[model samples]
Target: MGSNYHINNVNGPAIFGDNGRMEINNGTDAATLLRLADQLVERMRVESPALVPQAQVIQGELAQDGRPADRGRIRAALETIGIGVAAGSGGLALAQEIGRVLGL
Candidate 1:
């Protein structure tokens, strides 16, 4: 029941089991996932311009001060951009790396 984030080779972002398989879960902590989504957006802007717009949309939703009603939109956007977020401990190292890179 662990989760991990992954940037798929195609069809955009996705979430899967931590055991290196593609198994979807319910969801993860929005705050933390949104932060990672933000980082992914920035990275995509530099690495993959085509995904920037979608990523921006997700970022904007996450940035909203309310209850983040656009979680589904955010997930869809990430999926469209070949990114995924999972819930579990396996991604801690990658998350740390992202934080360091993004200076979060």
Candidate 2:
């Protein structure tokens, strides 16, 4: 069966699904992405210094409140870091969650 989605206290659901695949639209704002990215940086700096630059790119974009995040840049950053961070600590899971929040 396809996974069930539940948003207990959300404003609305933004989901598109068929069969076993589901894609969630981003009801989450840049701020939320920023928070997740921030959390990663704190854990990543010492745990995996090599991935810091890419993580910073994600963090910096989400911190900008004046404009929307550059999805291309953010995706690239995510790709770069996800490769390195995937084998490290629990940070990869967090990064993937952030990507899901961004609807990437």
Report the Cα lDDT for candidate 1: 0.53
Stretches of candidate 1 off by over 4 Å are 1-31, 83-104
Instruction: Write down the lDDT that model 2 would get.
Output: 0.74
Weakest lDDT window of 10 consecutive positions for candidate 1: 95-104
Off by over 4 Å in 2: 1-27, 86-88
All models: lDDT? 0.53, 0.74
Q: Write the per-residue lDDT of candidate 1 for residues 1-104, one digit (tens) a residue.
A: 99656544323334332345454333445577577767767666666677678767766876778563464575466455554334332233333433333222
RMSD of each: 13.0, 6.0
Candidate 2 per-residue lDDT over residues 7-75, each given as its tens digit: 753333334443433566446665666789998887678677888888888888888878977878988
TM-score of 1: 0.45
Q: Report the number of the highest-TM-score candidate.
A: 2
